[model samples]
Target chain A: MPDTIAPRSADAATPPTPRMSGVGRVLVAVYGILALAATGRTAVQIIERYDEAPVAFTLSGLSALVYIVATISLVAPGRVWYRVAWIAISFELIGVLVIGTITLVAPDLLGAGTGNPFGRTSTVWTLFGAGYLFIPLVLPILGLWWLAKHRPAPETTGASATSTAVTPGASGAAA
Target chain B: MIAWFAGVQIAVAVVGALLAIILGLLGRKPSDLTMGPLILVELLLIVQVVISIVAPLVGNEPSGSLLEYWVYLISAALLPIAGGFWALIERSRWSTVVIGVVCLAVAIMVYRMTQIWFVQGL
Candidate 1:
């Protein structure tokens, strides 16, 4: 079998696979792995030593939550789930940048006598998202790219233009 | 030792990644590698897991957080197995991406394992 799975071309009358295919599939798989990673780390912190760095530990928990949501959204089928995954991914991007920066220059704030106030700040975002060698940093960029690959319809001229009027270059009044 | 084993793992990952690249260039999809080298990588992972589980019992802790080290090991082993399955089902350029990610992940694990194995810092 060729297994090309037919990329969603403009010619296609039927909609593309509602669920992930191609790169999206692997993306989801990575999310699943990261979910496992973050979940395990957070569980360990909470159960073994919650007092060591509560702030860092809390962020780990939050990241874990985001990863779990992303993973579930990635694996499950449907438009609603896709939107949820997008939301989780967006939050992941924000979390990594914000937390990564905070832990980097403001080590004194997130750090502790134990060297980690939030239960040993071991999050995907800490240190400019270096924990995953910046993949935590790059994932959002790739996500947006993958989302773009779907080539959602131009919204400016659509009947529901009110919803997406703000879309870039939507106003074709001059044209 | 897991550290030594990691070096070998990296070597294997590089090879797997290269194969994925070559196959991708040839218009071969992820499904092409599903039953071939991909399975071999999974087999290597199984061996890796066994060695990792047994390593601590037979020897002293490497140096860093042993739990953390094992976490990397366990997850590393699972990467290709799950990734390969997903690739098989999806069968797109993404399979090549999976191989790339696995290679990257293994390299990172090797680096972390090295840090824990040799370094004493937190």
Candidate 2:
């Protein structure tokens, strides 16, 4: 008698949650590094000068939060994490662009003196992440590309059956 | 920290990073076999942490905020461990690459630590 396989529900098999493998690992590693870097930079900035530049420091804090969420989203499994990765990565791109433009156009707003409301350019995106060699400028674009490449396959008629058939082989390869 | 000693450690870690990159380019997966250099870098980081704490006690006060230095030191110690955790789970050439990244990060951190200690003074 041959051994039998356990049947899983269509909901379980057909969703096709993307695993953080291959190139995703590199992306996650980079995100994790950025998360740590941003968190550390913001913590030091906030603690050292909360009164000097509340707006700038707060933005730094927010940027750190975004990196942290993106890092987690990339590593986690499931469709929900996939969506979260998109949201976080998109937000990060927006942040870099908006803040980069603000700093470039009105340096004094984020620079010291002149009673600049936004304070000094202390956040990660300031001057397009010049302090960190512009990685902040480029990372989100890469993240977007990676996410697009790993986008879940569209739901199709017979997808459930196809997914069920492919499940074991997928699991085998993953293992 | 003893600036020269810490600099040496950072240099060695950078070299370790290069070795890991070579392994990655050669398509090597992370394993116990490839872990030796990474572990060495981690050990050096641990030593740096101790040196960071002791150096200040011995009158080589960090030029920057002591709190900032401590934070960098503690976080530096964790970088390799974090990379190792990811590597263990991934089990691919990318995992080894991640270790290279971790080493590079550690190198930069040590350089930052040094800058925080020495450069700000000048």
Instruction: Estimate the TM-score of every prediction.
Output: 0.74, 0.81
How well does model 1 score by local distance difference test?
A: 0.66
lDDT of each: 0.66, 0.76
Could you tell me the lDDT of residue A97 within candidate 2?
88
Candidate 1 local lDDT, residue B32 = 51
* C-alpha lDDT (0 to 100) for residue B70 of candidate 1: 70
Worst 10 residues of 1 chain A by lDDT: A1-10
Candidate 2 — which residues are off by over 4 angstroms? A1-19, A111-121, A153-175, B31-34
| lDDT, model 2 | 0.76
Model 2, span A81-139: residue lDDT tens: 87998999999999988888887787658545212222233688887776666888899
* TM (chain A), candidate 1: 0.71
Q: What is the TM-score of chain A in candidate 2?
A: 0.72
Top model by TM-score, which number? 2
